[model samples]
Target: MSSLFTPLTLGSITIPNRIGMSALTRNRSTGTVPNEIMLKYYVQRAKGGAGLIGLNGPNVLGFGIKFRSKAGGKLPTLSMKLEVKFMLSFGIVSLTLIPVFLRPIIMLAAGVPVYAPSAIAAQGGRFRLLPGEPGYVTPTEIADPTPLIAQFKQAAINAKEAGFDGVEFHGANGYLVHQFLDSTSNHRTDQWGGSPENRARFALETLKELIAVWGPDVSLKLSPAGGYNDMGMPLQDTIDTFGYLLREVDNMGLSYVALVRFDEEDDGPRGTAHDVVETFRPFLTKTALFVNSSVTPAEGEELVKSGKAAGVFMGMNWLTHPDVARRIKEGKELDNAPDFKSFYGRGRC
Candidate 1:
């Protein structure tokens, strides 16, 4: 039985412990950038000895330079995969890159995979960022990812080159990638729209770029079966799309995969984590498995022991409990809830 404190490797990085600070959106970064506040937050978790520290919130692709990352021959999984000389330390999985997504609900409504380069009002009222906003904008005017993807890749490379572990692609949440993956938000009929493969094309492109810089020690946070953001793909298609990604990506030297089975709301005691893991197991090999959504130390223990996932990601929990790693190891109790106010709103930690 592997303890929560046991070390696990994802791609090239080996976490000090299994307690990871899963990425959470803190209003610290501007223009989808990581600022000093964000840096301090991660440092705090690292000092706490959390296994891994993933960047919280926003994947910027438009301001980056693109690279062909998958050519490293299925990228090798080194004992210290992405660790470098002098830099911020990270674990097996390093979450980066904001994927343009397609909400299940939005996809169901539009009958296709929604694609967005930015948060544009494509479908209707609920689609708009602000209240009562209308219709979607042109993909070009709304989002020119050519630039952002480049920036995203550079960011990942910087993290890795800086001596941190691998990077995690932020594919979940209603971010840019999420908007596109969901049909409700994306109504385009171009090569990047209509079909599932086409919808997945952009993501594939982003993945390839990240691999070019960070190699295969990468992980993606996907909601293929994610119910939040109104994901509406049929069981089969959801399975099919993920199958395609697994086949295409895993072979390219993927370190592991992290799936968000349900909306954050559906987590907790509902067995959402277990159920989602079951859904993914059929398609994956020995790749590291991770589940992030309101994870408790006890819950994480059960998950690892049950073989549901290889690692656990603590979101707001890790923020409040810097000593969470210590508590779990010492058999001490953890703070279930955190000081919400301090978690967000820039400045000092």
Candidate 2:
């Protein structure tokens, strides 16, 4: 039997197969709400064979994420000029005042708790999540998660309410959570900044709350080698920050840690971090380590044997072959792989 097709248990969740789905951006949110298409898409994947699928935006709600989409679904090809325009008028200093302004509004609107790492607009854009195709939002301004955390918590509650298994925090994409972790993007001397440890403070605290509400079956997704929006940090810094975060969360008994791996080792930490996979590899001691990104079956098996990884994840390949797990198990040939170009929006052949 193909180990890839095997069933495994992480924390309290027992997935039927090892072929888990990684989060793919599918521009399908209202900046505040998920559209019907988004729900349908995930439900489709769940029915198809995905053990878990990470929700994009609400995963990381902070100022570091850049939502280039305007009031329409069109995302601006951002250059320094546009940001300068927005900053020169009001300046980013006042951007820091956003949370204060939004707090009262959220309290009045949702009557629930709210939280964020910084007072900036952020998003975790799923690739192909643009409009006019088959997704949700047409792209607009980035929404602050501070006021929306309660809503996301409610969304998680709703997911639970709807009978979904569990939720994974999307911290890897160049979203708010990632924005806070990478130092180059976080210069604030506040609690969320000062050092890598401090930057991870918000995520840690947020995890606590998530566990309080959702239990320990939650998972977390992260990529150490990304450069996005305002969040920037050297490889060494990311290693230090993520390493610390894994230890902290491990103690909390989080379910799984999905480390999005890359090929090149140049990411200061090692070109998109493959060279230094070892540094971050140790953090998975308490939980299962899910390494993904262009990984072949042989390499995955090696990692498991070498004690470098727990399981492997295939993102794009799983799109077309929703039954990939069953096929791999029975040794049947995989059907056509989905073209990356068609993975976005709602259209597919």
Candidate 3:
């Protein structure tokens, strides 16, 4: 049997298989609230045999910052009302029908006048909004991150009350948390910048708050080698920063950590490490590690079999093929072709 079909345990939760669904922002919500379409989408995936289903975006706390869609339209920020509705809807569905573990990827704001450890503008061109554009604004250096940390704590409390299996912090893909971790985006002189320890302070503090609410049920998503959102530091800096962060996370004894691998196809500024998982795997001695980014079932199986990853998280594959896990188990081919044109919209796929 393929290792991908084998069960894996993370802290107290046990997934039936090693093929988990990575969080993909489908934008199917009505305003900030998730509707029937979103519910059906997750239910189908769970019923199709995903061991774990990760929900993204609408579950994120926007901190009143408006997000822009791929077509340059303003996306609604998440409100407590919508958050509760989202959690209840998915939570109830998971409890009743699907035995799959449902984890929402909670993110900090990612929009206009972006908040960061320092006031740096993302590099422009090709999928990124240029300077002076409607959505482009240099980040506002956060004088105090206390209020923001409180928002994360409250978000965790809501998720726990709503009965989610766990919550994954969106500390990846150059969002606010990632911005703080990356030296290029975090050039502050305060206690939250300069050295790698100071840089990791924000993420650690926020994760501590979440842990206080949910204990080991909390997980984190990281992209140490991701160049998306114009984020990349020098090679050694990347190693030192994430290496230190991973050691700390391992000590916390969290459920798991998901790492996004470097994209060879991306034309943007690439991070130092080409194989992100391999580079940082040693630091994560105790916590279960999941790898994402264009990974295939065969490769995922290899990773699990080789003890490199506890599971594999698929994004596009899960989105395109609802029964992706079953197909992998049954040795069926996946629908590799994804409709890029219809990737994002406020409608059913």
Candidate 4:
């Protein structure tokens, strides 16, 4: 039997198949709402055979780009409302929001400054930052975790209103939650920074708030040794920090914990350590765990069989091959050779 086609339970929800779509940011939202193009794109993927679709929360505010309607601006709003409702009715998508990243996008949309855990700058050119420029604008340092915690809680409540089956907090990728987890990025003297428990305070508190509103259906994504967006914590510190995090969330009964780690053989900084997923798998005693990377169908099956991951997540593959699950199931070749120029919004594809 193909592990990819097997059913898996995520918290109280049972996914029809283990093949799920990882969140993909297409930069196609109107400011805070998904456009018709975005709707069509996801609908295609759903029809193509994905069991679960994780919609990228474009900004921290949980708003996408503003809806630009051709029919007096009402069409896009109506389209999005209908689309979200329709997708939920299909019972196959998880809407997610990344705290710091989405907050920056929200602030930018409102013509205001963005904020993070600390004032540290991002490695240039990752998103919109120049080689030597800060990746964010007027990045405010979060001294108190109260306001942000409330904001995230409210966001979770709002997501429930939007008909999302679940919400995933983007704790990976050097966002606010991640910045707190990384000792080097968080240089505060408050309870939110400094020691491991202190650094973990913001995330745990915020997650607690979210759970209050959203319960066990909420999920978290993490990159234990994240180097993206100018993140570089001590390797040992990274392991220890994430170890603590997994243990804390273990009994929370979260829907799932998604780890974005390197493949088995990649020699990146975190790659040299033990497999992040396998090393941390024991900590997730109750929570469902999955890993996302350039994993092949064969490798995914092995990971599931070896009790490493409950399932696997695919990203870019879904971009070009919307029916990636079906293709993998049938042993058919995938068609996702994306043109780099088009991918970077520099081409007329």
- In order of listing, the candidates' clash counts read 51, 19, 0, 11
Point out the higher-scoring one by TM-score: 2 or 4. 4
Against the hidden reference, what TM-scores do the models get? 0.69, 0.66, 0.82, 0.81
**Candidate 3 lDDT, 1-349, residue by residue in tens:** 3788877777666777888788776776644355557666776777678887776654455311222222121111121212211111111110011111112223323332335677666665322222232323465678898788898887677555444567788887767788888888888888889999999998899989988987877888888885876778887898999999999999997888999988765425566556888799999899999998889888998899999999888888887888898898888999669877777652222
Q: Against the correct fold, how does model 1 do in TM-score? A: 0.69
lDDT per model vs. reference: 0.54, 0.53, 0.69, 0.65
Give per-residue CA lDDT, model 4, range 224-308, as digits (tens). Answer: 7566555657668877888888899887778888888753333245332446776788898888788887767787888888777
After superposing candidate 1 on the true structure, give the runs of residues whose Cα lies further than 4 Å from its correct spot: 28-40, 57-151, 161-163, 264-274, 346-349
Better of 3 and 4 by TM-score: 3
Residue-level lDDT of model 1, residues 197-309, one tens digit each, is: 76666667877887887776777777665444333455665666666765666666766677765654532222123356777766777567777776777888898888777
> Which of the two, 1 or 3, has more TM-score?
3
Return the top candidate by lDDT: 3
TM-score of structure candidate 3: 0.82
lDDT of 1: 0.54
Candidate structures ordered by TM-score, highest first: 3, 4, 1, 2
- Residue 96 shift from truth in candidate 1, angstroms: 18
Q: What TM-score number comes out for model 4?
A: 0.81
